[model samples]
Target: MQDFREAYQSTAVEVQENDIQDNEVELASPWQRIGAVLINSLITMVLYVPLFVGTAMMGDSNGESGVMWIGISAVLLLAWGIYQAILMSKTGQSLGKKLLGIKVVTLEGDNPGFVGTVLLREIVYNIILTVLGMIPFLGVLISIGAAIALLVMIFLDGNNRRTLQDMLAKTLVVKA
Candidate 1:
């Protein structure tokens, strides 16, 4: 009986050690996450510069130049989206994340593929937020509150600093 108990205890310890190693990931700090977000936002805003310039050059009239500019803007936006999706899917790092030395990964420490990164994290999450924002009277307020809640969740999650998008996509941001 004593020998059996010893064997069981050793096996349990080995299992525990393996579990700990599996979950050993250095989570990104809140500041790093915030920096990444700001960097990404800046990149997005920079991408709109051409659109703004084209609009200004074309004036208020919907002439041929205006239409062309609109087309250009659409193409630029689409290209940016594709770039982000590709990077996120391949390496779990967007331009901002790469700059910040952070990456998005599954809870198991694997890169989240396109379905998780683009579909669930980006498209579905944005759709939900957009739907909430489009509600009748309280739409704007609800949307703002939800955004705040998501941000707060990142800070409040003691074990894993996951936002709502991360939770929905079953992903985590960790140091690259």
Candidate 2:
């Protein structure tokens, strides 16, 4: 441990961070991720419910009940995720990430706001994992794959505490 710290000190560059409290400087756990997701979900629901209700009322005024409201809601949710990713990459914090006292950055604490990186990590990778899980019987296989990916992210060895998305995005979550 002493040797590792010495090497890190000699080789690793320290990044100047935000006005983050010293006590908050800890690698976020999976539970923290869950909390962020919950917060983001709540925000999304607030936006969705109103739109759905308004669509229902408009549909009632017409001849038929409009099921397209559900479809629209789905699209809106996807849009929200994209928006969240953009905000997270730009500001280093999503609404939840900010509330939870964590921000995503690179190992060197620089955030690369490349769209390709964002899509690769948030849209392509995660959605692929999720889609596989939707398949019956194949869901176990999908879950195993996703678990492996998540484990790889959580256990980043000595380099940094990051997940697959972090690696792909060259980013990490630290106290903010």
Total clashing residue pairs per candidate? Answer: 0, 2
Point to the candidate with the largest TM-score: 1
**TM value for model 2:** 0.59
What TM-scores do the predictions have? Answer: 0.81, 0.59
lDDT score, candidate 1: 0.82
Q: Write the per-residue lDDT of candidate 1 for residues 45-119, one digit (tens) a residue.
A: 877876776777676665667667767877888898899899998999888989999998876677889988889
**Model 1 misplacement above 4 A:** 1-23, 56-62, 157-159
- For model 2, what is the error of residue 155's alpha carbon versus the real structure, in angstroms, after optimal superposition? 7.9
Give lDDT per model, in order: 0.82, 0.67
Whole-model alpha-carbon lDDT for candidate 2: 0.67
Model 2, span 75-100: residue lDDT tens: 78788877887786687778888898
Give the distance in Å from residue 144's predicted Cα in candidate 1 to where it truly belongs: 0.8
